[model samples]
Target chain A: MLVVSLIAFVMFRFVGDPVDQMVGLETTLEERAKLREQLGLNDPLPVQFWNFVSKAAQGDLGISYQFKRPVAVLLSERLPATLELSFVSALFALLAGIPMGVYTALRRESFLSKLFLTVSLIGISLPTFLIGILLIFIFSVNLQWLPSFGRGQVVDLGWWTTGFLTVSGLKALILPSITLGLFQMTLIMRLVRSEMLEVLRTDYIKFARARGLKDRAIHFGHALKNTLIPVITITGLQLGSIIAFAIITETVFQWPGMGLLFLQAVQNVDIPIMSAYLLLIAFLFVAINLIVDLLYVVVDPRIRIGGAEA
Target chain B: MSDALLSVRDLVVEFPTRKGILTAVDSVSFDIGRGEVLGVVGESGAGKSMTGSAIIGLIEPPGHIAGGSIELAGERIDNLPLEAMRKVRGKRIGMVFQDPLTSLNPLYTIAEQLIETIRTHLKLSERDARERAIGLLDEVGIPAASRRIDDYPHQFSGGMRQRVVIALALCAEPELVIADEPTTALDVSVQSQIIDVLKNMCAEHGSSVMLITHDMGVIAEAADRVAVMYAGRLAEIGPVRDVIQDARHPYTKGLMGSIPTLMHDSDRLTQIPGSMPRLTDIPPGCAFSPRCPKAFDRCFSVQPACERHEDREVACLLYDEGGRP
Candidate 1:
């Protein structure tokens, strides 16, 4: 996380001046110098970095250069939209991916399995931006069913504002979430399919069959649980990636998420938002991996002993 | 054979490939009498395991029972539908795999595995099934059965796991248990313990066992009767003592010779001249004929039918009344 903070801090420098974006060319040099001083941009490099880190640790992320608002408040407002989109996308990916994978694995020669494999191949092959554009083109321009831009009709609930309560907000989320989640869904599906295939061939599965276990018990109860050990780790990391990489989907739909905020901050050399976003993404990845490690203990007993000893 | 608990007649298992259909078990036949321990010994690819798989209806796709019937306690199970066959499996015919490490699901507790198997084939409640599982565990000689039943497979040592496997197989008290190399993967010291548990438990349950292994010592110790397979065909079969002491088939003699005996003064263990023939390249005559030291003109030209000589069935031209020199 500190390494990411350092990188984000370095990005704050040498990526053009926030003062250039803040003021027009007619502003006097003295006025510009005063503004830089006021923002502590005139401080030594190490001192500026120390101040950034210390203040960030205390929940103060300075202020956004373009919006003239506190960076923490800006992020918190956009945070809900991004989190909701990510949650939906992650849920969509897993719920669709796992069963699709198991189906393809169990019925390797079936027509539907082949069709799913083909569609997933397309899902994996196409870039996120292209999928997002194609979705917008079909759903917004051609069919005119959903709005093309912005979060619609958010319902504020004191600390958090959410789109889930409104019909239009939920409808607007469908395209972007699908566009964001499609790649991850295909990835998880293929992973699960291969894992299920491998698990099905294991001696335990054969023994389960020989024990006269029902087909459902053998497949889901025995084989599927074993297959999920690796799937959990992959899905956890993918969840992090989905949130971190939602920028393309956000850009295409013009959704009011942190990715869009990050984009705007990057364009205007808004150091506070840019650095804070980087640090936040890093923290999410670490936190997700920790949860995945803990989940291993729950699913597999062999890991439980090792975890206890460790 | 008339009083057999499980009988297999002219069983043919084949695997179809792009080139041609390969006959893995070519018209093999055998029987396990009630409470009998029938040890099946052979080299790798001898179809000993395939025969066991055929009985349980577990022959994988592209490989299948090409011909012959399997009867379990007088009912034709070979031609039964998959759903019917499944019911016959754990309830009437249980199986023990070679690797205890991989046989039990690592994710499940031993109690969970055993209770499920018991409940699947019986009408016991969960608590009753659990108690039965624990009882079987104790019977199989797992120390602290009641407490350790909830432990995962990985928690048990190799020998203990095999014991657990035996307990699981015997929990439902099936009529037949096809234990395929049940002791092959254990320690030398652990091997006898596992074999003893398997044999004693089956004997107690009156469950017929078709013990498949390549270990001659195991067959000598555990088998009431022994069957030797040569390239998917039964080379010879008889009472274990008769087959071990006075083998009739040339292949069976060669197999007995290869075993290092304390009584034999020979410096080197005898080895058969060639490996078992692959399914694709099996000779037109008896599969062992090409490698048989006693091979002659008739042996090369004619496939020998099994000839009954006293208590043994030998597939050799030498045993034929008219074909013999």
Candidate 2:
């Protein structure tokens, strides 16, 4: 977290000052000095960093220059939007990707399997921004089936708010989620297929067959369970990337999420918001990796024993 | 012949390689009668394991039973559909592979694996299956069978794990058990214990066994009848004592000659000159002709057929009626 914060600090520090972004070019020099002094921008770099760190540790991320609100408040309001999108998209990716991969691996020589492989290749190769635009063109402009952009009206339930249950909201979510999830789906599918192939060739699988186990039991029960160890690791890592790096999809769809907020903050030179976003993303990656490690103990007994020994 | 429990006739298993077809088991024929133990002994790469795999329909892809038939209790099973073959495999014909580590699934408990097989082949309640699993475990000489039944494969020692595997194979009370080098991966001290357990369990259950191994001592101690293989072909087969005392085929003689004996003090053990021929480069006539010390002109020109001698079957020109040279 410190390294990430320092990197973000150094990057934004080298860029032109936020004062120039906040005020007009014709502003008087005295007014500029007054504003710089008020914001503690006149302090030395080390003092400035120390101030930022102390404020961040206390959950006071300062005010966003662009939004004119506390960075913490803006993040809390937008966090649910990003979480909802990520949860739905990740659920879709895993539900569809793993089974498709298993089917393809089993029927590797079939034409349908070949087609799925080709489609997954294209999904991984194409950029998410292009996929978003293409989806909007087909579903919004050409077919008039779904909304083109913007997160639809949300229903606040005190603890959590979601656009997913509403009709217009669900329609609005389809294109952007698909655009965001395409790469993850393809990544998961390819990983599952390769892992399943290797697991199917293992000695235990062969012995399972010799034991006269039903093909379904051997494939899904034995082989798929073994394959899931690696797949879960990849899925957890990808989930972090999906939530942190949905910038392009969020921008194209005008989704009210952290990615869009971060983009607008960068444009308006909102250093506090950008730095907070960087630190949050780094924290998220570390947390997700820790979760993946714990999940290994649940899925595999051998790993559980090893962990117990440690 | 009618009482034979498992009869494998002219079994030919082949692998389609980049360089034409490689016949791994070349027209190998053998039988195990009711409550009989047939030991198949050969050097490495002599297709001993392939023959066992073929009988159970577990030969891996690109390697298949190209020709021949396997009959279990007079019903042909070689050409059965995959589903039907599966029914026959664990229920009628059990298999114990060489490596105990590989044979058992590491994640599941011994009881789970055992009960699954027992319930699948036998119509028993889960409770009944659990009882049967424990019973089989106890029968296989596993100490504290009830408690150890719930333990995972990794928790057991190597010999104990192999015993668990033996219990698993006999869970359904299969009529025929194909044990392919079951003791190969064990310590020398544990090898005889496992073999003794296997022999006693099979005898108690009255199941015919086809024991595939390269260990001559195991065959002499455990098998009633013995089959010797050379380059995928059966060289000689007879009562274990007769074959050990007076091996008819030259390859069998070479095998017997190589066993070090305490009865005779020999500075060096007798060994066959050359190794078994690879499938791709097997000579047109006898596969053992190049290695046989008594190779004659006819042995190089004509492939000898397995013919009955005084008391055993021998596949060599010397055993032929008029062609003896």
Candidate 3:
């Protein structure tokens, strides 16, 4: 985490001056100097980096010059949207991908399996923005069944707000979520298929068959459980990538999420928002890795023993 | 033999390859009476393990039973449908694999594996199944069976794990158990203990056993009868004492000579002249003739049929005549 903040600080510092974005090229030199002083842009690099580190530790990210609002407030508003998208897409990917993987692995030579493999190949190879446009064209423009862009009507619940409560709201989420989730789905499916293939050939699986376990029990209860260690690891890492790649999907769909906010902040050279975004993403990745480690103990008793011993 | 618990007759297992069909087990026949132990001994690729797998209907894909039949308790099982066979497998026939680690699922507790198998084959409630699991574990010589039942495979030592696998194989109280090199993966110090546990527990359950291994010592200690396989063909079958002391087939004689007895101290153990043939390249007539020290024109030209003499059967032209040599 410390390393991530240091890298973010260094990278943001090297980018073009935030002052140029704040005050236009037409501003007088004396006025620019005064504004730079007010923002502490005149300080040395280490002093400026230390100031960012101290303020970030207390969750006091500075105001975004473009919006004239605290970066924290802006993030709280947009973070939930991104979180909802990522959570839904990840859930969809896992629920669909794991079963599909198991089915394909069991029937590797079947026509349906081959077709699924080909479709997933396209899902992985095709660009995210292209998929978003294609889905929008098919579902929105062609069928006129769903909205083309933006989060649907927000329901302002006392504790939380979401656009997923209404019918049209769900319709709006369908295209963007599918567009953003397809790649992860394909990735997880391929990973799980390969992993299941390997696990099915293991001696324990043969033993399970010998024990007269039903085909369903052997495939799902035994083989699938064994395959989950690698699947969980890949799924967790892919979850981080889903959030990262949502930037492209959000832009294509014009969704009100952190990815869109990040894009606009980058365009305006809003250093505070950009740094806050980078730090939050790094923290999310770390948290995900920790969760995956914990899941390992839950999935495999051998790992649980090692964890307890450690 | 008339009251045999399990009967396998003229069994032929074949694997179809790009080149051709390779016969892994050729015209093998045997029977195990109730509570009997039949040890199958052979070199690697000699089809000892293949015969066991064939009997259990566990031959891998592309390798299948091309002929003959298997019967359990007078009912033909060779042509049963997969679902029926699944019921017969753990309920009537149990299998103990070569590697204990491979035989047991690492993710599940011993209690879970045992109880699942018990419940699958028997109409036992969860509590009753768990009780049966613990009882089987105790019968197999596991100390603190109740506590150890909840432990994973990795938590047990190699010998203890083999004991657990034996417990699992017997949990359903099947009529027959096929143990393929059950002690091959364990340390020498624990091998005898595990073998003892397997022998005692199976005998107590009144289950017939087909033990497959390349180790002659294991066969000597555990088998009531012995069947020797060479080049995927049964060379000899008889009581363990008769086969070990008075082997009639040249291949069986050579195998017996190779065993190191303390009384016959020698610098080098007796060795058979040539290795077993590959499945695709087995010789034309008697597959063992190429390596037999007593090979002759008739031996190489004729595939000898199993000839009975006294209480044993030997597949050799040398034993074709009625009188004993």
Reproduced native contacts, each prediction? 0.85, 0.47, 0.74
Give the range where candidate 2 chain A is weakest over 10 consecutive residues by summed lDDT. Answer: A7-16
Question: Where does candidate 3 stray beyond 4 Å?
Answer: A24-28, A158-160, B322-325
Q: Which regions of candidate 2 are displaced past 4 Å?
A: A24-38, A42-47
What order do candidates take by TM-score, descending? 1, 3, 2
- Estimate candidate 2's RMSD in Å: 1.8
List ranges where model 1 is wrong by over 4 Å: A24-28
Query: Candidate 1 DockQ category?
Result: high
Give the per-residue lDDT of model 2 (tens digit) for B1-325.
7778888889999999999999999998877899999999998999999999999999999899999899999999999999999988888888888889877888788988888888778899999999999999999888999898987888888899899888888888889989999999999999999999999999998888999999999999999999999888989999999999998899999999999999999999899997888889999889999988899989998998887787788999997889977
Model 1: residue B162 alpha-carbon error in angstroms: 0.6
A33-120: candidate 3 lDDT, tens digit per residue: 9998998888999898899899988887788879989998898888878888888889889988988898899999999899989999
Which tens-of-lDDT digit does each residue in B128-207 have in candidate 3? Answer: 99998988888898999999899999999999999988887887888999999998999999999988998998899999
Which of the numbered candidates is closest to the native, going by highest TM-score? 1
The worst-scoring run of ten residues by lDDT in candidate 1 chain B lies at B299-308
Worst 10-residue stretch by lDDT in candidate 3 chain B?
Answer: B316-325
Name the TM-score of candidate 1: 0.98
Candidate 2 recovers a fraction of native contacts equal to 0.47
